[model samples]
Target: MEAPLDPVSAETVSISADQRSRPYLRLFLISFVLLFAELACIRWFGSTVILLTYFTNIVLMACVLGMSVGCLAASRGRNWINAVLPLGLVAIGLACWTLQAYERGEMSIAAGDQSAPQEIFFGAESVQQAPLGRTYPIEVVAGLFYALIALMFVGLGQVMGRAFNAIPNRVAAYTTNVFGSLVGIAAFALAAALQTPPRVWFALALVPLLGFVTRFRPIQVVALVAILFLVGWLPPARNGAARQVTWSPYYKVVFQPSTAVIETNNIGHQQMASIGNSGAAYLLPHLLNRDAGGRPFEDVLIIGAGSGNDVQAALSQHAKHVDAVEIDPVMASIGRANHPNRPYDDPRVSLHLDDGRSYVRKTSKKYDLIVYALVDSLVLHSGYSSLRLENFLFTEQAYRDIQARLKPGGVFVMYNYFRQGWVVGRLVKMVEKAFHMPPIVISLPYRAKITPDQNQAGATTMLIVGKTEAATAAIREKLAESGAFWIHVSPAKNAALNGYGAKAPEVEGTMKEHWWKIAPSVVETRGIGPLPSDDWPFLYLRSSMIPGLNLWGIVIVAVLSLAILARFAPPATTRPNGRMFFLGAGFMLLETKGVVHLALLFGSTWIVNSIVFFAILVMVLLSNLFVVLVRPRRICWYYGLLIASLVIGAFLPMDSFLALPGASKVILSCAVTFVPIFFAGVIFATEFRDSRHPDVDFGSNIGGVILGGLSENLSLVVGFKHLLLLAAVYYLLSAAFKRRAEPPAS
Candidate 1:
């Protein structure tokens, strides 16, 4: 019973045990850092790089690419984990600072005699418009920057993959990884909850740094200190009198005292001027006086009540009570603190922080006035899809729901700085269709002068929709008495008829004239074109036409990256099974679909996104635990269950859920959406457990995620629900390709 081991053998056994234990810790640290980095990229990089905000999936795809490269490297027995991790952190940090400086207009380059080129990387040219015409240079530079970011991720991925391969119990390692990810999410979320700025977020990198680099050399220590110092020191520039800068869950909000406007990442969001001085107030008197017929409004509802300016306007109109619904809490808080009107603190105002459309649907009480005031989002809903936060609010059905919320003789007024004449025409047409009557459209210029030649195309447009014809007539009369320049769009002719009278000759081809008379018909005849619906809410994009050059460029880069990966990390001789690849692709599609669907149901707040991501990880963790414990023998059963769940989800009445109580709606939606996700997890775990080479399998899975990210763009062409069908097809393909395995020896 007592055969003693030789000294050398005993030492070797002790070292092996120590090595085994060390990797679990490494796995946890790596997982935590990777997730933290991901969130940082999504938030920090997204805010700084304008294109990143529009095409958010690019960041996800880049991360996947890097991680895939790293995992592939691990499979080839090449691990540069320690050397690459810290360098990657420093690289990303510096890139973020440089981008932020450029975005703030601090960075400049002399081109010939010009101080700066007409088209710079983070200039106005980057926003809203399709990436066409002289945009290639910007695109090239952005692509290279993103590629570097991917390379950084590759290093982290290699570290993680190495740790994962070393651990004998894959399930245990996976659990630790998931747990660490949750911690990362929680930490970042907490920082956001506290309104931590970018500097505080940068400091979070130290957690992983401390864990991984226990014995840093003098040079390494100096580099780490310098990086941290730069993160804190590199101040974000201000446009006007920058009173405060803070991070909301969804945006980086800045309050400028001189302008009295709240901005999201330097873009104007909410004007906080006094009620008398505000541009928004121009439409208020018209609505209150004309629709109310001099009677005081008993109750008012203001959607997108940013900075409480609209609420203050309502209060000034002697509304007895006001319901202000705003989605961003940090923005609301700024309104409370910095608004000169102090409308939020008034007893008459009851602020509800929620999605505007969701509030409209849920509220039982009706109001005399419903104002949709300057409610546009600065950023798109998701990078992959051309949807926005306010997309649901502008839909035709949403207008109908809003119409239903109006009391008898009540008025629904909307004011926006519509950038194009066609956009103004489109909103007017939508209102006419909803109310069965043409709206009274007024064009208010930013400056006091109203020249007939002045292109009213870009002016602040207001639509006053009346519940009754009498109310409309009264509003029209009041506007005429005030000598305001307004137009009544002829719904049938699609012509802009002069509302001011024959005394004022119509300015031909101007918004005052016909002003793109064919805009509405063009929109209508296009057959669901850019007009947003609950199903397809791409409000920012004008059409479904894909940016051909941009799409092709991305594809080329992906192909080239793939070639490089192939050259460096050759696959195993067994041809490395592709069943896992399909499963990975399908799973990514499901996750993207879920994120979008949930964003539509709930608000597309940062909290909602984080929660959805956390929920997905938890679901995957549960699936792995189930497989590890139950060890299901029939993969067919799991696949069948997955398909059935998806089918159920596809047919579920989403509108019915919207009508339920808030908690009930959330619970039901989660059940319908996540049931399929759970089954998908089970299927993946079943296949992944049998993988001969975990590193290669993991890399393949990540590679599939890149394809899934690209495929997500399909949502723009075919609405989001159809994406579920696409995902199901991928899952079916996975099932078809799945190689059957013999039962484990009994």
Candidate 2:
């Protein structure tokens, strides 16, 4: 019923709802479904199986391969959407269990090893074993899942492809598709922020999938239910019980009620324990500070203060104030409610759920003591190698930032069961370089041959650095008087400490004598290890190179992509539009550079990550809008601007953005990061509008994007800044390819 604007006016205006064309609605639905499904699978597969954490790129590549094939095959005029999706979901669910983090035999990729100059998966360092009877190689397992995931997306892509073909104005269709994707990302992100369960995510996906299905038979109904069951399947415990799992923005967190142990992605993450009852290592820095300076710490800061063990320890030491910074909110929540000591509940403790380095950089307060306690997470970047949640927390630049926030005589301590001695040596060197003084070191289970220990690196080692040389001098003097840098509490104290928790690491004969050994010189500390900079904050990596596992993954994905293209692509246009393909490839890298740059300028928090993604799409949308409104025919201008922006971005390093004032930083960073992408999008939309076959061009573009994803590995060798140059090469090639393929009429 329509109401009149004015009561006095007898003339009633009839208003009818502007109908959205069915093809556009279908396009929106399919695009929304594809994005949600892709994100859901990426987040779920890694968290559920745990083994797939390192192989996330495979899942990503598989989606690209599938969609590429599906879109390319749309010309054949056949309905690709059928019962295949649910069947594919079944296969994926089965793959999650058949392959896992650990089994009868160890499963590890190149990053699995604890050696130098190799990619490092942080939380995967601990030796793992499962009760299974047999196992397959990592290569074989990764390959199997890659093919399965790709097959599932093939059907969805074809449906979306057909939708695109139905629309006459390709620009309008592209806008709707991008807008749908934006909505999908925002919705999924909101669901994650709300800490919705896996079932909710799958349910959200099921809504769109049901729309595409033609049949509602009993078998199809069963298939839909089965998909929910598979994705929401909880990891079963050893005693045939399912552990309660919580979905964090980052990972699937499982907390053991009895042991107070918290696990992420089925791997042991942290424990809520008391220092008075076996967490003595947590007090070492304060003890060292007190013994050296004969004063208690007034203000303390604990980065990576997982589950409040560190915070509780600070309180136990009688700190006046404690600032605990933890990245994962779910981890902090469990710590607050479950930790026996109630650290987070303490009046002195203030918990901040944020990225550690980011917190440290922003806080104006200076601390007498700062602790980096056992901070590690398994968060690999989709485009880069072995990036963890805590990666930026350990870089030389990060250390400098921490040092700036320290009180004049403040002492900084970071302790971890760092799997390798080289890791320790690298860390020590970084601290020394940043602080301008060699830090005091305490390596538990210390031994001769500094480069030895079968890569054990003296498990549970601690490195202590003072803000200045004078503070460090006092620490050294106290250590010298104490005979050794180790702690040797009486047997009674040791027993009391172990009463409430697991036994802390102890030296062989440490009832009264030394509990630690004097660290060796830089030479014995291990041959000049490379320092981690802001540009390359890969603390766990041995060096800047792609790990072997990823190398094989890229090759495998490329090969499978080729095979799929050959099989499903139409004979007439089997090859993708090369120009569009190259543009897609280059744009992917351009997009990564934007994300990495902003991540560096700000912090790599989930919020920041999501915003960067949204912003990138927004830029694309804006550029596409310009093309749709203006309808520019010439592409040469955009190519020039795109290349110029790439060059500007490449030369302007991320570190420069760090010093800018708050408002300026946001403004300049966005311009530098988003401008190139904006230009790139304009070029793509212009070409897309001109394409005779949108499906083929799009498929080709996706295929090229896969190649760009592959080239991201080179960032390991050249670093993120140089990636712009590589992207520029691709853009130039794209322009050249277009010029040669379709010359302007003379």
Candidate 3:
């Protein structure tokens, strides 16, 4: 009792204690940083790379690839967490700056009417008039840049995997990792909420580096701070009072003072100039005029009412009341600030920040004029799915619902800069099929001069669909007087108009055929393809084939990932775990489905997506906790529960659920949709708890996410709801390969 311990023994004991605690803290930090980096990439990559705006899952796949490579390194007993992570941050910042410079140069040239060298990586397809030719040199250079960015993420993945391997209790480590991820999501979300730019994100990400580094070098700290500042301080490509660019949760919004217009991702979105101020007096003129009997519209509804332009149009027409629905909060805020008419502030107008389709389905009020403004999205809704923000709005079924919201004699008007003749035909067909009546089509040239390359910018097309022929006739007479050129879309209407000696609108010979012959052929052959529905919402894409650049990019990255895995991952780490892989893939699919389903049921706003993601994480964390606390031994029972939940989800009527009141619908939908996800989480946690080498298993599980991302493309063919069946199949395969274990004695 009196014997004193030696100094060496005491030092060894202290070191042992520190070593035991170190991995836990490191794992948590690594997880937090990994998530932060992923979010940063999503935002930055999507904005810089135009291709990513359409195919966002590529960025997600890159993040997964990096993590998988890191796990391989950990299995090989390699650790470069401290050295590579901070350096990676600096590298990413520099890369972003360089890319922005390149983009600015290209855009400036394009805007000046000079054809810039085509970007080979994104391809010539996006450029309207650019000739299709392979620029191998540009492709090679861009590919290397993409690879470098991917490699930076590998360092983060390695740190997380090594920390996971170091921890004694795998379940505890996993729970901690999930908790850290939650924190990472919250931190990023908070930054976004504050409208803090990329610099703040970099600063937050680098702060964790202080704990990782052993020798605190002042130069390293200075370098890191400088990089953060550089990233934040760098000027955007397009910057001026004429152009105001801001980051929104959904898009990079650009407002032009000259035109008083707001564009998203270089695509014309909304004309901010009020009718009274702008020379475009012909725009929505029919809406301004009295009805068939010269009666004024009592109420009007404007969906996709961006920048309050349509609301102002309704107000100028002296409508008693106007309901304006705009999905994006940022757009609404901008409208409130900038709209010269101040229509949103008008007593007659009620602004609803909601999904257009959801609003039409749930609202009790009916309107005399239901105007579908330029409700088109330039980007996908989520990275995983092909669904766009306005996918639900253009569906055939959606048109029917919109028609129901209109009074008996009320007219439904939809107009957009439908560039492709086939796209215009598809919309015309959709509206005709919904109402069983031919819609009046009007095509007008852009009010301002535009280059041939800016064809979409140079034309405005309108479709006027009426609940009755009398209503249609009333609008037709008004539009006829406004010098609007009518294009016959429906076969019966086309024949009747021709017999009446109504000449087709004068245009380029090729363009005339495109509108008359080619347009109708598109509908006749059904070659314009499946009209977007709730089940399959991809309004922009005509075919199931992934775009050329997207396909190539995916293939290249996949090949590169496989090469890295084969070269660095040890043979022992490559052992097949079908159960884990399948579970992981299924879980990812389920998560994607949940997000899209909830977005449709609630709204496609960023807040809804964030809540869904956060809720999923919480469910997964709780499942892991349940596995630890209860130590549930009946794995089969959990599997059964998972299958049952999926069955219910598959057969459950989404329309009926959507019919419920908004609050009740959101709550019930969450419960129904997430129940399967909860059970799936339980199954994953239970199996993970039993894994002997969780680092290897965890890496494999993440690998499954890659496959899941690839499978998400199936939504293009099968539609989204059917994706649950595909997910169930993966789960079944997982259960088939699962190893049996005896229940623990109570």
Please report the candidate that would top TM-score against the real structure.
2
> Residue 70 in candidate 3 has what lDDT?
70
Instruction: Give the alpha carbon lDDT tens digit for every residue of 397-516 in model 1.
Output: 778888889888778888776554445555666777889987766555323322322233445666777777765566466445644433323221222233332233355443554322
Better of 1 and 2 by TM-score: 2
Give the higher-lDDT candidate: 2 or 3: 2
Note the Cα lDDT for every prediction shown. Answer: 0.65, 0.73, 0.66
- Candidate 3 structure quality by residue, lDDT tens digits, 516-629: 311101123244656766667666555655544445555776777677677667545557466777888898899888988887787676677778888999988878777777
Off by over 4 Å in 3: 1-22, 82-146, 214-223, 233-243, 256-263, 266-268, 277-282, 285-293, 446-458, 477-526, 544-550, 570-578, 651-653, 661-664, 736-746
Q: Over 4 Å off in model 1, which ranges? A: 1-21, 76-78, 83-138, 213-219, 232-243, 278-292, 382-385, 445-457, 477-530, 549-553, 563-577, 651-653, 661-664, 738-746
TM-score of 3: 0.82
Of candidates 2 and 1, the better by lDDT: 2
Scored by lDDT, model 1 comes in at 0.65
For residue 292, model 3's alpha carbon misses the true position, in angstroms, by 5.6
Supply candidate 2's per-residue lDDT for 118.
Answer: 59
Q: Say what the RMSD of model 1 is.
A: 7.7
Steric overlap count per candidate: 1, 5, 0
